[model samples]
Target chain A: MAESMTETEQRPSGVPYPGTPEGRRGTGDPGFAPHDGQEAPELLERSRALVDPAMRAAVESLPASMRRIARYHFGWEHVDGSPAAGHAGKAIRPALVLAAAAALGGPAARAAAVPAAAAVELVHNFTLLHDDVMDRDPTRRHRPTAWTVFGDADAILAGDAIQALALRLLAEDPHPAAAPAAARLADCVMELCAGQHTDTDLEHRAPEEVTLDEVLAMAEAKTGALLGCACALGALYAGAGPEEVAALDGFGRQAGLAFQLIDDVIGIWGEPLRTGKPAGADLAARKKSLPVVAALVSGTPAAAELAALYGKPYITGDSEGIARTALAVERAGGRDWAQTEAADRMARAMQELARAIPDPEAAGGLLALAEFVTRRSS
Target chain B: MAESMTETEQRPSGVPYPGTPEGRRGTGDPGFAPHDGQEAPELLERSRALVDPAMRAAVESLPASMRRIARYHFGWEHVDGSPAAGHAGKAIRPALVLAAAAALGGPAARAAAVPAAAAVELVHNFTLLHDDVMDRDPTRRHRPTAWTVFGDADAILAGDAIQALALRLLAEDPHPAAAPAAARLADCVMELCAGQHTDTDLEHRAPEEVTLDEVLAMAEAKTGALLGCACALGALYAGAGPEEVAALDGFGRQAGLAFQLIDDVIGIWGEPLRTGKPAGADLAARKKSLPVVAALVSGTPAAAELAALYGKPYITGDSEGIARTALAVERAGGRDWAQTEAADRMARAMQELARAIPDPEAAGGLLALAEFVTRRSS
Candidate 1:
């Protein structure tokens, strides 16, 4: 599954802001004609409507001790435990699962994969909870991270229980595909863990010690693996054979990589109002994100300057320093490289999607999703 | 599954040290002999032989970054990653799984349950790794804890991977019972997380605010739940009916409670030489172990003294304070209550085992293993 979809349907339209660098603004839209001529939000909303019951049931089934924290994390309850309208992300991963199922096996397979979709979402949130604790991240989705609210031990426990719940959902399912889905999901979890370990390990070393390849691999494992697994699971539920499953997985993984590249770009230039995180926070923390690594190894004068700036410790409220650092990275060709890399990855993703489902009409929902995630915070 | 086995076969013989109180010094020995009169050590050793490869394969399958830390945690390799003779534990949990399977369906059942057995052990180690981090414990199995050897982040990631591996093993097994067993194992993990959550929550509160019943429930959840699940999984593999599986689960849970009660007692009164940890370490940390809570709520005069002593923060190397604290617990009848409670639990366990497997000879291995754990630290 590797480049036959038209460039117009696979390219993202870039949004320019104050921090958006030259050569990256207003790129062409990935002109996907979604199902029923619908968009990603519609597909996501439909998927959410179908998957919400299963997700809520899984959360409700948790023991009281863990249920409270999970409820808050999922945005279904306030910190005080009162009900709230859920704001649990765009529900993108589950949408991917449902879309992939629909593409291969129609509505029936999509419905059959509900438990698995919920399981995938649960895994994503589980990693989020643990990652917040490990990274000492203070906020997520415009609220205090669970560890900051319930304390680290409780947050960790909640995450542990959620992971179990995820597996239990599949294990208890009568669907024949459930067991293989579980094994694949569990394997994804280990990859996620290893990715996190590498991320943390890399963070402690000098910027020069970290390679672009290493950071890319870390991103793939950390971010791409789950997306791949979700799509693979959807294929399994649809009774798609091994080749199709692998192709779908590759599609998701490539899209996920493009998603990461765009996400990293957003981490540097995204609007706070849209992204729910402060602009340039990653740079402020001296995080060795993909663009930063790319710029560091560019062998240019600006790369040296960027390296020197990163060598020094970041101080709080150093907005001036952050601005200068962002400039150095741009001058070192980071932003342009990231934009090009994202387009390349999305093209690869389109190839995989086309290989798996040759008809554009059948693949509309998935095509919309991949484009949506890549363009989400632009 | 209640009260049918002979009393002599369920009671554990006691070993006494200077700290052992008068009432608990030499309780009568359990008289049920092991298969071929081999006893627990032989059974455990044999089971270890059977399950070790599966455990090793699971660990080795981990990604390179996590594998190093997991290897160190399992005592299979040193911190530097060179090989070492494995000292993972006594292999008790897996042994129980094998024993229960054999009791129900003989050799084939036991053999089929190997992956489940390895999965259980992995879950146990995963919990240990996280608990050590949360508790900030400096040692485990007489060596530096994983969190201390690697940083907290790496240890946590390793634990996370091991847990995923645990479920993955069960998920990958082709046996008919694997799905149910994985679901059961995952459910136990949730219970384990909740138990740990309660334990951490209780640790931050005043000792007097804690109740005996609360601690008892916590102990059962933390220690007994997995043991019960292990037995139930074994019974599932053996094709046992629901009633028989429930009985075996009951047997394991009761025995687990007894194990915890004695472990708590040992935490407060055993010789450090045998226990491999300081005798008063739990007391020094003001841990709300089973006996400690029992003593605190005793309503005896010594209970007040113990509470007041526990109220003051412990200074390291205060041998006099530790001695006084141990004596206070004893005088308040914590020791006596624990011994009596353990015996009652053992009796209940015997009843469950007899109900599930009426033939004493067939049940010999399980009986011996249960008695061995209860007596090993005595």
Candidate 2:
């Protein structure tokens, strides 16, 4: 594994080079070999251990009802306020925050970035709670979504409270970097809102009228902005210069785009059990996901068929139609295009990381996180 | 008018002592006389001029679609993107922010408080936008509410964006007080969410099951917290000590409570044209407003009748039922109680203002604004 980390040219081109079943399913890129997956999971566990207490403390600061809703949303409590061993998220963003801090300013800097890591995690969950309500998605992380359990108003309010708490945490931090960190996070939130607005607006338009560039911009705002902010915040807290912070932000943005591309592919073809969603859920809803959009604009015969299918009203029980649409999207080369784009983005991400931290040892954990995000079937 | 400003004891106990037609209808408290309304309007105009440019600049920083929605919400543009002459709001919160700053420090301090003033105004409008969506209110400031025109998702997203922008403005300010200002603003937002959560929860339960203390706490959270934060932020910006800031916060809190009490009275009894809402609209929705809660506990025959009426489902378009309920609330002394409470709060507000700023001349604008808020028919 150490040799593979040093030998960047021999690393997997697109997929995670770790011995998970899904990661091992990579296209046969030359000289690529799957290493044991122990390192990534251990790092993730460490990050969670480091960040969870602060995150929990932030959620606990919310008023009673909101605190209950937030705790439940974080999988820390049951609906009845009893402790529950539910699945929290993978803590990927917080991991990136800590890793970036450590990369820039070593261990003490990483510790100083703990509040920022928790803040980013809070912002991420805030988006999830609101997104679930806005999209009317009933489930998340294999559990009923907060909106479904707490009712829409409470869910939305919880999201709002969490977002405020994120900023409050940063603003109250004694670190000099706190002010700029808060400003950056707030800017990212506005971008997320703009992206979500554009996404919903696109859904109301004809498939043929939407441009790929618009979709990509929306994806960057909706997904990449927060990830970039997470990394930038960590660097800022580490007392890194603006250029270093910007470099980390760029790295995270490319990785985020790659993550979204792979996620779009998985949405079409991933096993529902692994993804923890209904089979072909995106296609069933005729969602304008990246792969589907690529297909609709491909100008192939299958592209026309896919567009026609998307134009029709998507009925809830029409699994057959959904499967057919997914097939048409793949036939138009949307799946392959997304896969290639993901690989390209991954390469770009590595380039940015190298520019920011020339030492391969410092970049190892961030690279592993990027691979983990892209390689996850879920 | 100057003599009357010094003759505080002879001021009207409940209503505003400004020379408006509605103000002239005040109950005959001995030796009370309406002063010319010119001072409050002039002060409001000055405050708006001071705060609007900063507010506009903050909104302009948002991305395009969100910027458009926020501008529209602020009455700066028509839905078609043309400039409009729509009334934004009374700008009361921003006025309080500046007044508090000037009262603590000199006029130069008011200029220094511009960002804080803008921040508080943004927070105020953020709450209004969300409240309209949550209550499904169709009209605000004599025009269609943002949610009605822009759709619920956009209105909500716009509100979220504006809120983030408020904190961003504070964080970006070069003032030493920016960090604490941002923290205070964010904390107030959480309280607002908690209050809103309790409010919605109350709506789902029988009125008899809710206590006046609970309702008052909700009101303080929903209304008084932000007002207090605004004043505290202003005082903080003016470099006031903690005790002075706390006193200003107390002043704003009592004024805010008085504001809510008068708003409840106006909701049920004010003229529709003046209030810009249907007469007895609160009764029409059977909202658990403070006056209604007071009347429910009054133990009068009218209170019993009101309780019986409230026990039934509130049918939409039941204007007759709403009017009768309003009459019952008044007959049970709810109106009288709210009026007395408002007067008591105003007295407390004055006391706190005196503690914060011993000179009555410095306190004149805040006093006038408080009287205006509680006294205005709208």
Candidate 3:
């Protein structure tokens, strides 16, 4: 694994990683702002404004028993059922949908894709709820996870209901693309389930037994599939042809991979105050994240040292040990590998976007969104 | 609360209840044969023959990680990845879909409805998988449940995937009714979630704090909603009018309640050999089943005694205590109330079926299915 990624290769200190409040990325773009005068943040804001009402209406249709759990999960309500300033994610998926729609078919297509946008957002949250339960995640968006507050059964039920509601939105839409969108979205859910299974299954396996390819496939399914489907659905709504839809899907998938790579890098190196967790929290949890796995398989002297550190369970407040492990990985070229791979993936994403839209101006919104996603925490 | 002839009202032995090999019901009509030359079992058999292939094909489409769990849950495969003599329950929901279609629009409609039939069955099994996880059920279809074999996370993921597959089937179908069916099925899923929440929540509540109406509504939501959706989907596929679809939904809902009522009675009184559980197993588990809740809420002297017995948890090997508890519920008129209510629900189901299809000959299959469901067990 230590091919060109040797200790001599280096990246700048500050790289973009996902900056979700929960220390993890799920449904949204989080709190990132416009950079380099890009329209990505503005586009995301517009997407959220458009999608939130539809999402709320869809959530309202859930049975009262499940509605409370869902509302709280969405950051729309407190545990006591009182209203709250919603901190629902930055509508990255919805923004992708609308941007893709507009890129190919202009504003009318964007307008027509609103329900599908909401549907994608709902699906994202549904996965978040279930993933929290499966991973036993205690917090999300800097608050107690739905499972922690409502218990496993309720969390699971709420996720199930939300997923149903998501597909129902597409199923009920009068748009000609609705059925196809539902089908695509449903396919994405299966991919996601399989991805989550692979994820949890990998966590149980010995680190040496897992390949980098396996990790990449898992990340692609877990993180890339939905993003790709969101763009694909938008293309369908825009009356795009098969090739165009496929290209847009490719674009989103590569962008999503870039996002995961950056996110994983940050998990090892991001500031504790920003990520809302202790530095190297993934390391402390013994999570087989991208860089850690990359470092372990690097076949260098430091790879052995990193593996030795990973073999032992993390001790609480063992900052010195964490620092040593981080140094070992850096020496083994894991950080450099991740950053290089992320940049490569982003380049591929842009190529795919251009392949479908040819015109740079038409693809600018999507291009900006993709860049924002890869920057300092996608 | 019971205000009937008290303990004087008695049901004869051998009342037909759902005779699934598993103690609980979810997907199928189970292993009962035709009664009085009724076509219910025959219809279920044919429906299974038609729908199983579609169901299997859809399940085969799941990712390998989830496919094994689903195959095992459906009793198509064993824990070690070996094939089993498939004991997938009687295709009651699929049978309902086909029978309702056949009743309203003949053979063409029935054939067109096959995909919907499979979709309904998939949804049913999806719920079964998740319910097994949430309820910590050890066995299903007389085998170890998916969760017991694969662990909680995999089972949950498989369930999630199966639900998506169900919606995908509808979404991909070219039939005009597909969208409406997906919408209704999605709504039913939400209702099922709410119902399951109520079921678990009620189980945690004190016996005296629970009410009969609450249990009834829960049963309707949890059990009846899916059945109703199955029938409604069938109706939609048949190009039936709103009134016909509504009537079929009502018909299935009432029949499902009857099914639950009979199932609850079987819980209290069925032979251990038949139920694959100890006598009064539900009582031992302190489940707030329909009859038990009715007894608790009954304003009778025996109600107090039954409540007192229910206040304490049952000990393992305490058959005598279980018997005593069963008798207390019986004396509180729980058995009579359940049987009478089931019969009444069956009558209402018949009324709705008649309204939907005035010609008795045209409705024979549905009539038989409803009768089969409500008989001693549903």
Candidate 4:
């Protein structure tokens, strides 16, 4: 699929694909931050107080080798069990859960505490583990994949455990609505699995096999559902009104879609050194990403040529061909098409943000959080 | 491992050691008499009302290939879309769910309907599908495995989708306690995964290498958890007290363990012409089963010889050796040990059954259920 890369010049060179370390993006607004310098320690302190014990309890229940791999993935254990501060993820998803809940008027102190934070974090990790296995990925967060370490079965089982722990924590919470929260969480998990199934199916199909509608549906199932659930559950915790819960869910849904498109862009054209993933890795894998699909549908000469090359099965040592295909896709307006879509999605997300009736400042903070997610560089 | 067949009375001629159907055991307690005589038609009617719709809906959202395999496994489809009444399982577990809920004073009407029944059944099917893949089984329920028809990936994704559907159904139930019920179900799901991990590991480890304690733990994790969850959820649905819930869970747990031990016996000494699975199949696979484990710990000379024979990596074609090993294990008191253990476990299970304040008539029915499970013959 060929798309003109010339019109979209603001993109940074190197960022890892989604589900990787370099994929982390935050708001570009200079004035916006997760916390003021003074707030960082308290947030970290509070987070650690809750996350550590829950994580330990969950992992301890796992088999030894599985625990080892999970620990390594979480930056808690080295391959050889020596002390090592491994690359902990930014924990953005969990932070979003807390921030959204607090923004909905709950005390940040209890809203963002251990069990919830740990639940959300574990959900994120569970997805990472399974996604890596399905994609046959070998590295994540700039380290070897968990499957590569503990073997695929152990990795899968560990991931499954993390998912269970997420639900278990929510159920065990003493909140009046703990049961309802768990029910909501289970629905989101179903969406996650459905999204993944769609994603996996895309690989075996033609480049033009999936439509924009399908992509949107897939995004809703994959990324949007989780983010929306995060916000909705947060609002529930904060005792936010029904309208506010609905608004935040809408906001998260739109923002999550935009986030996925931006991440897709980064996967293809991003710089290898910065991303910590091989350059044009997505192209080499011939992933049926949005831009590639867009270009394939455009019917331009460049698109035709690119599609011709992609019609064949993927081969090793063909990264150069894949790169050329990527270039052709760019020349055909695919890149511009995706960028416009992402911006539109973001605008709608902000519109939803504006409809919220929470405290203006807290709402503003959540809005800033959304912006941070779509705009950040890894 | 060197123990001779002459040392034990367990060995019998005309009982195929491999490549022959295993035997089934029936309790002869006439447990299903009450339901079978008057309630059978109504149960089927009620089940069909819920099961048909839920089963259709669950697969409706899945991709075509996944749907195909699932439909095939459900005995709903063939390769050419011709009408095929596939081998639908006995649906014993779902019946247990409904019966347990009904026994706890819940109406067996909509409460015992499709989504929950289908969900539990799908969970069982999900396990079967994956177990087939892991055990390298080529057949299930007397037919080719799903993997044989749809390939490993499709079979896996199908199983995964069904699992998601199970959770989704539980979460979406309109009952007030649906949320908590779902959370409990997830706990069971996680335990099942843990059990599967242990079971797979046992396959790789020598049969005698693992201890009886470990085997019991594995059995509890693998089979008991789901049964316990099913019974507990059913009680929860019926508005049963926490005490009742705990008792039902205990009942299912003990019965499930006993079921496994009996299953192990069938796998070894079954009548080859009756059970679809090969007789002594577990022996050929050198599975680290209950009886095998018991034999290893008995400290008899025959037990020592059995251990040596089991240590060999390959036993696929050594049917004679397997028969000899089986006989030696019996002579060493392994068979007796296992039978006694099974009986003890069954007694314990029945003890739990005694705690429930079931209708005296229903109490006998429940006991019959337990006997049927643990002492079934086919």
**Each prediction's Cα lDDT score?**
0.85, 0.81, 0.83, 0.66
Better of 1 and 3 by lDDT: 1
lDDT of 2 at A134: 84
**Judged by TM-score relative to the true structure, which candidate is superior, 3 or 4?**
3
Residue-level lDDT of model 2, residues B162-266, one tens digit each, is: 989999999899898888889988999999999999988888889788888888899889988888888898899889999989988988888888888877877
Candidate with maximal lDDT: 1
lDDT of 1 by residue, A276-348 (tens): 7677888988989888999999999999999999999889999999999988988998877887888888878
Please give the lDDT score at residue A221 for candidate 1: 96
Candidate 2 backbone collisions, by pair: none
What is the per-residue lDDT of model 4 for residues A1-378, given as tens digits with 9 covering 90 to 100? 212222232231121211223332353333323444213334445545556677679767665645666788787777788767754665555655666766665565345444666676777788788778777889888788887887777776777666766776765676654555566666666667668878887777887667867877887778888878777777667766778778778878887887777667767777455456565777877787777888888889988887888787668888678678778878877777878887777667665765774233455445555655565423
- TM agreement with the true structure for every prediction: 0.93, 0.91, 0.91, 0.82
Q: Is candidate 1 or candidate 3 better by DockQ?
A: 3
TM for candidate 4 is: 0.82
What DockQ would you assign to candidate 2?
A: 0.76
Model 2 agreement with the true structure over A2-99: per-residue lDDT tens digits:
23222221222544323232433332423123233325666678889999999988887899989999989999988898999965878889889988
| Deviation in Å, model 1, residue B133 alpha carbon | 0.6
Give candidate 4 misplaced runs (Cα > 4 Å). A1-69, A80-84, A108-117, A174-180, A208-212, A239-246, A311-323, A357-360, A376-378, B1-69, B79-83, B106-119, B174-180, B238-244, B313-318, B358-360
lDDT by residue (B1-378, candidate 4, tens digit) is 113211121221112112112311132322223333224435544555556677778767655646677788887777666768754765656666666666666465336434566677777887787677667788776778887876665666667666666766765566655666666766776778778888888777765568889889999888888777767776777777888888888888887887787677777776455556566777777778888888888888988898888887554677788788778767887667766666666656655655664343444334445555554432
